[model samples]
Target: MSFDIPDDRQYLESHEWALETDGVVRVGITDFAQDELGDVVFVELPGEGDHLKQEDDLGVIESIKAVSDLYAPVSGEVTAVNEALFDAPELVNEDPFGEGWMLEIDADDTAELEALLTAEAYEDQIA
Candidate 1:
């Protein structure tokens, strides 16, 4: 199946994606990732106000296939976590980039977003 790699976002080799808007960085697993993981069963996310560094483990995503780490794409304080996922983790598979977003961070440096891989680069990696 083809995956959606949005041009507006940045991605990591490990399959996390980040989108920067209004100085906030929103993070989630890529479509390729959720597909590979099978059905999501649980999510462990950081609380709001938690601090993180670039590449730090921000949370865990558990699936029938495996349990994977969710990393921070940029250093910052977490402004929000998708608390809804705690109740309905299947959303991670259903709408990963939208209502399924894992967290929003107030980025420490906007330039970090530029250092990330483009959607094409990410697609190449997964391909």
Candidate 2:
């Protein structure tokens, strides 16, 4: 399956994406990524206060078909995890860019965000 890259976010080659706002960065799997994973069954996420570097593995997301690593899109300490996903993993498949966001981080590199792909670039990447 293929999914459209949203213009509102910055994308990584590994399929994670981040939305920068104020001092916080919201992280999640891209639509293309969740489509590849099929039906999500579980998501194991980091706790608040956990520190992560850019490109670091932060947690795991399990689909009905496979398990995928969730990477940090930027360096930061985790501020919150989406508690709703604990019960409804399909939230990732149903609405990845909205309620399916994995966590919010207290961001460390705002300008470094420029390194990520734009929506056009991300779509090109999968093509």
Candidate 3:
């Protein structure tokens, strides 16, 4: 199967993607991740006030295939979360980059973004 690796976003080897806008960054699993997980049934996200450390567990994603830990790509406070996922976890499968985005972070350090892979590199990594 094919996958989308958006050029505008930074990707983790673990398959999460981060997109920065202004000072805040949006975080979510990549299409490759969701597809591999299959039919996401539930998503447990960090609360708005929670702090996440890079490479630490951020939350859980449950799918028909298996449950997996979602990890943090950067250290930051969760400024907001996607309330929509609570009602429709399948959004992760349907639109992994758009409405399926898990949360927003007020990044403690944007320099960490440079450490993430470019879309091309991620595609090769997945391949």
Q: Per-residue lDDT tens digits of candidate 3, residues 16-120?
A: 999999869899999999999999999999999999988889999999999999988889999999999999999999999999999999999989999999999
- Top candidate, metric lDDT: 3
User: TM per model?
Assistant: 0.98, 0.95, 0.98
lDDT of 3 at 96: 98
Worst 10 residues of 2 by lDDT: 1-10
- Candidate 1 Cα outliers beyond 4 Å, as residue runs: none
Clashing pairs in 1: none
Residue ranges of candidate 2 with Cα displaced over 4 Å: none
Report the lDDT tens digits of candidate 2 across residue range 10-71: 99998988998997999989888988899999999999999999888999999888988888
- Writing each residue's lDDT as its tens digit, candidate 1 over 12-77 gives 888999999998999999889999999999999999999999999988999998999888999999
Task: Say which prediction, candidate 2 or candidate 3, comes out ahead on lDDT.
Answer: 3
Ranking by lDDT: 3, 1, 2
